[model samples]
Target chain A: MPLRHLAPMLAALLALAVQAAPGNGDSGTQPEDRSHLPQLGDPYLPPAARKPAQRPPLAGAALQAQARAKLQQRFAAADTLKTGSISLAQAKAAGLGYVVQHFAEIDRQGSGRVSFEQVVSHQQGAR
Target chain B: MPVSLKRTHSYLLAITLALAACGGGGGGGSTPTQPTQPGNPADRGFSDPLAYSSSGNASLSVANEGAALTHHSLNLGGRVIDYTATAGHLIASHPQTSQPKAAFFYVAYTAKNQDVRTRPVTFFYNGGPGSASVWLHLGSYGPKRLQVGYPATSQPQPFPLVDNQESLLDTSDLVFVDAIGAGLSQAIAPHTNQTFWGVDADAEAFRDFVTRYLAVNQRTASPKFILGESYGGVRSSVLADLLEAAGTRMNGVILLSPILNYYSNCAVYSPGEANCTGFLPTYANTGAHFRLTNPAQTDYAAYAQQMRSYAASTYGPAVASWLGSRLPPSNSLVDQLVGLTGARANLWQANLSLHPNTYQFQLITGTVLGRYDARVTAPQGSALASEGDPSSTFITSSFASTIRSYLTSQLKYTAQTSYAISSNAIQSWNWQHDGQDLPDTLPDLAAALQQNPNLKIMVLHGYNDLATPFHQTELDLARLGNVPGLRIHNYEGGHMMYLDDASRVRTKADLVTFYASALN
Candidate 1:
């Protein structure tokens, strides 16, 4: 199943586990006892609440390629203050600090800039 | 990890050697020799001894409370060193067997020139697994206060200190603790930064501190109290539970602009059934205070009576309806309430929920120059969505100015570097705990009252504090029911209700009475 569909089922399962556990007042330490407290009244409502009129899932590879393109665009903007190579400070100033930090960890090649193939390589390595 | 530990030790050694060399006579005249025996292990007080000495000119004489305070650093189980310091003031003399703990504290008593009184000591702290007790130490109730209204760059450069006639020392002794890493406090061995940097870990550390304090101070008979602000309120609950388990008790617990329920308060800012229900009443009350609403009432009690009716009847339904359908008519009372909150009608018209940022900008821009001081309104400007809190700017500025001057000039504790007032270390704190998932402190509060029967709890809140809305607090207490001796008071101010003149005076009076009763 797609990750999007899997997310809710996982959330529901977690909630169920919490409900099954005993009450200890300390929510972080104990599994939540959902039985005695209060029930959601409707369990099916969540998925229905989130569903739009109509939507289609993008292929996983296509989604990855799209994400790579967006990241490259951001890197280009962040390289504005580059002195031959972009720096973290410049990336921070350009509002791409979060992305720059992530890319830095993934770049691995020691190159100043990242290429599409490098992006694909990093994506594969992550899995 | 071990390499980093070695590097840190080497750095400390180098700094110690540098200080020693500088003391051997450098640029200045004859060097003052380091005390060979370390100046009475009990008197190695205050992390920054120089800040207290050179800044204030008052003569130091031990008051009736007794011996001078002793300061020491404790390893709170982390690479980050925590200071476990206290002042030893004699409350009463007793036999060796009757002596409680040998306690020490850091205190900013009345300026040496002022008349001394047997003031009630109000113990205060902030919450954050990583937060120090600086918020109460400098911003709200300390003898040395921060000055408000000044640009960040336009300092004299360091502001002059003033005598805080407002200091609670006249009514109570104050003790501020730096939890784990945020302040001068450090963690003990075996417990790393991660160990002391979470919910349970922080509570256990405070529990240890309290246990140690009671054992050291002999204050077992003294009326004990706690004052926690923001997340500290949540922390106070956990501390209460731990203390109860240890058989210790408190006279009262005061929560200042507390964040008790993270899901209800912090996660949601806009007006929605899920997020905004708890906070709307406070927003309405603040609007009523600023004369933004149609009701031009100054008395909050009368206004609250009127608001409760509206909240249960009209306002509640209108919100439910608006959430379900297209934008309701502009003339609706809900719209008026939203408008009075200083939020743009269009935004409410668009999103139905008004985030804290919107309400803050909408309400104060015309009268105050900054977003923090809702009391002061600035000139109107083009309405734009704010990225973060405008009030934080004011809170940070006011605290920075007040604590710096108060610590150095009044109490006479000097340090090499400025005190760390607040940090982002606790911004993303999680409160969900395992096991009995208690409200953290309520059970302890119940136990304290059950144990003493005379213990009273005074819960005060500013009507305008959207940070911790009054209604949610009311609901939280409702779940706990009446504790027989507890009294709840609602003030006519925001998160820092004591900043308001009337509320501050009233709070002081109430505290004095409460302390007298607790002791008697």
Candidate 2:
């Protein structure tokens, strides 16, 4: 079978192994028996009653890449001189707020302009 | 491997020298320091939707593998403690279907040759709501600590790691577990990390993680404890209750610089409408620290106590005037506020409430006090500056770099994917809990107390912590009705109290007493 078709099968096998594994370890090590203790109800609100999750659709590198792409596009647009770099004034005009904020750090050589690579590397180091 | 080597060059050199002294048996297991990327989706056991490439190329996924165990000994002052470090991932699955949902990355340090039944095990996590457990692992009670001085930004070069004389390893085994989407933890296929980002769901995931950890390590009979810092406090409150339901009874629950209730956190309220009663004492303490108070109080604790009494007696009742009737604070109250908080009389008159930001910015000329730590200040930066907290900026790089070095070079657990020190999922966190839009976990804690009266609770605070004011935690825990099992201690440091050398020693001593009491 193709690998895509095998993904769910492997997941199922892993899930079965997970289910078969002992949970609470009532043996091996002497475990506490809390049968006499009062039992508590469900710890969470019912799914219908609970508030919906509010997480952003994209996450991890995918989200970061989207953001990075936007910045690069902005930089490209700002580099109207086609000198392969953007000056602080051009950055300011394009509303590249982050570039304007860290202009000195990005323009490390003090050339008053920064390449797209410099911006990318700076962001990676910051992360 | 070269990338890993480059990042850990300094630490690798140190480890090489140290191994030479130890006669070379202390190296971590044969697990590769850099894990090979999974070739296919099935190799990782599931398809990771998060495994995407911006370039539309083949994406990489973290391999599903067993832990890498390393053995080492630390000479903590004089007494040496030999410990085994287990660094890896444990799968947390769906409750009903038992399908793997998320992988929780954890680093566990257990004293070698200790009896599994008797040795205590404590789980530690820092709270960003989306933060990794790196802070508690490197900055606080772990066997090795990242050294960065307070009140000034840490220099990037020469980030050092030292044996933590105050490591809790002597008292109990420590396990630092990162939440899903943070550190090396990741969500499996069909369930995104967002599935566990809410208040209740987050607690459930942790409850599963803890139970799984116990079963796998055969630590079920050990005296159990959970320590949560900052937003981890919220997770702990709910987790404590959920763990009880799962039949894992903890001996103690520790809250460090916790925000137990968000309704009164001042972040939820508009400026001038926030409750100033809880914040007054913290402001007074900060003022005294800067010698900004009128009396030039040298004794910060005593001044804070005086302010606390005044707030409870006079300011607490008078707060209703502004919060309810839009009435101005009494002139006497205004005078007292100005004298204690170092704010101008006009500012206090115009607004009875003093927001932390206003105090942080206006407390001193040309300097901004840290929100996490009022004692640390920096020359104000541009409005669009990436980092706003002086406390965070100065010390963050040191901690960040040190963790990566320590993990790969020392602990020997490495990953292909970048370890996220913090995730951005908090931007869309579901705040609703127990029907309140703003979470108040005190009820969950109270329920845990009711269910397990034997559960010992200790709430710690730093007097200089502006993020979670000490007084608010005091007021929140007061509703538990004077339970003797509960102990609250405040130190003179910031939110991460262990960052201060003096506070770390004091806090460790306090924890030593707490662990003994709980175990007994």
- Writing each residue's lDDT as its tens digit, candidate 1 over B1-520 gives 3323433443343233222222222221122332222243323333332111111111112111121222222122232111112322211111112222111123422211111122233467765434556656655655444543322323432334443445555455467765544443433223333444455556656666665444433334445677887667767766654454344546667766665544444223222323355556666667776677664657777777666666667666665565554343355654666654544454454334444434554444332222222443323331111112233333454565665554544334445545554333332333334222222334334433333355556677777665566776765555445566566678766666665556666876776676776555
Local accuracy of candidate 2 as per-residue lDDT tens digits, B1-520: 2322332443343233222222212232222222212221111111122232111112123324245556677788888787667676676755545666666778888776566677889999887677778888988999988776675563554357888899999999899998776777766555667777788888888887887777656677889999999888899988887675355768999999887877656633434545767888888888888877888887767887898798888887786566565555578878888888787665555555666655655667556676677787766553211244566555666677777777776666666655667765465567787656656777677656644668999988888877788887887777555677999998887888888888899999999999999998
Q: Candidate 2: deviation at residue B496, Å?
A: 1.0
Best by lDDT: 2
**Which portions of model 1 show Cα errors greater than 4 Å?**
A1-127, B1-121, B147-160, B266-273, B317-344, B363-373, B377-391, B395-398, B401-418, B427-430, B434-453
Error of 1 at B33 (Å): 28
Worst 10 residues of 1 chain B by lDDT: B51-60
lDDT of 1 at B428: 31
Where model 2 places Cα greater than 4 Å from the true spot, the runs are: A1-127, B1-65, B154-158, B382-386
Candidates in order have lDDT scores of: 0.45, 0.67
DockQ of 1: 0.01
